[model samples]
Target: MTAISDRPQMLPEQFEEFARHLGRTVEGIRLEFINGKLGIKPVPDGDHGRIIQWLNRICIQARPELYVHDQGLKIQGYRGGFARPDGTLADADAFVGRGDWATTEDVLMVAAVTSFDSETDRRDRVEKPRAYAEASIPVYLLIDRDSAEVVVHSQPDGVRYESVRILPFGKAVHLPEPVGISLDTEPLKNWVR
Candidate 1:
């Protein structure tokens, strides 16, 4: 067998340094600080944008008080996981300045449209939800292109969500009280490979 992978694990402070480096070098493509490691992801594609727009429209319709931000959500906890979801719903007041991410406490929900990339798939389904929960963000929405389905994760307990609801493509998924309107998922059909 080949030698074990030698990618050095990044310490917390080191992760912070890397974040700064990314800021200076890569402008549009954001990196993830996940479970003490820095992860690089591909820029969103056309299909990804469609899903993001769909989610944003439904979010505003359901709760006018919430702002649907495309990317730019950072969880403020010791573990240091950074999330730039395809779409994030936060209380109107959460957006204060020119920063990339908003405060985790003020966030209502986060949503990501899965890319064709496998690394991104794992982050969207597993790592991101866990990190968002750990920061106590209330809801996690995942539109998985691989399975052609949507999953709503709620009742977060730091490491995971206690409740999970999955729905196949073209079916509407109901968000909780704060977001009273349902997401019309028919557009998901157009996200062709």
Candidate 2:
């Protein structure tokens, strides 16, 4: 008589090899796995790139704890899920002994400069905010090129944030305690979208 086998037919580890293979071939597009689903983000436009650059410089200057990370951006989530924000601010100490990604534990905020495309706009304003909140990133700073405004979202609870503050170009918006950044908006006003 043939013996019955107890081992599972397909182990979970088998699938990631396929994903890794797919990831290697993609170019210019950003890929993420959020809550077990795939998310694709297009390359930022020229204006978006400038906005990200400005945010990086100003944030690092404002706080010693903040740094500009250009690549390999991710916030760790369950079951190998990761989300890549355009730019990010995390405690400088958090990078110790890690590779490939950054955890949300020490992430003070995530930054995104919205695209002119409608689908991209929704992804930035809606889907990303929820994902960031779920990862427990304390703040989300969104520069809406469409509206010529900056919005700060903080105090995440579940899939939503408790605080949503909007500031038009040339208006001062406090980044709140912990981050505690007081940004001068004059340059942002001068920024041409």
Candidate 3:
């Protein structure tokens, strides 16, 4: 059988049109454009949803003035890419009036809860981090269920994250400036695969 892949399936404009149409017709799939390639992100499992919930609660409690979920961003710096982060931390009105793909400006952080899929490694762990960093997003929180770890990528210098800190599921993850908050990841252990 031919190998299924996440290669450059289509050009950026075509991808955007396809993604928009799919968003209206499809029920649970999400599309991303990163590194000039197309990626399909399936609806997350229950545990994956729970992890996002867990982080959402902590973020709300720590920074009541900001919101941390339900946002998409334009990324890959000048590459014209788009992504719908599992959870996007930004000012309450950061995406107000912006259409489906909003600019990455003022985005404090983006979180990804690994789905149990073949592309989890490359999509969540590899491409996304680079894309978010290139877009100068302050932080990228990876809830890697497969590895049972939390990988924090921060301090982007417009290329890649200069600082990366990985911690087991049960430890606390300290997010740096712009996203000045601490995550009590003890609850993450129960949700990992």
TM-score of every candidate: 0.86, 0.78, 0.92
Q: Would you give me the overall lDDT of model 3?
A: 0.84
TM-score of 2: 0.78
- Give candidate 2's total backbone clashes: 0
Distance from true location, Cα of 149 in model 3, Å = 0.8
Best-matching candidate per TM-score: 3
Give the clashing residue pairs of candidate 3, or none.
none
**Candidate 2 per-residue lDDT over residues 77-105, each given as its tens digit:** 44345666787777665666765455667
lDDT of each: 0.75, 0.70, 0.84
lDDT of 1 by residue, 1-193 (tens): 5333433367655765677777788865667777666777878888888777777777777677777776466676545657677777876667778376556766778888887776865688778878888888788888888888889988888778888999998897887644555887888988957
Per-residue lDDT of candidate 3, residues 67-125 (tens digit):
87577677746456888899999888888898898888879999998888899888888
Q: Over all chains combined, what TM-score does candidate 3 have?
A: 0.92
- lDDT leader: 3
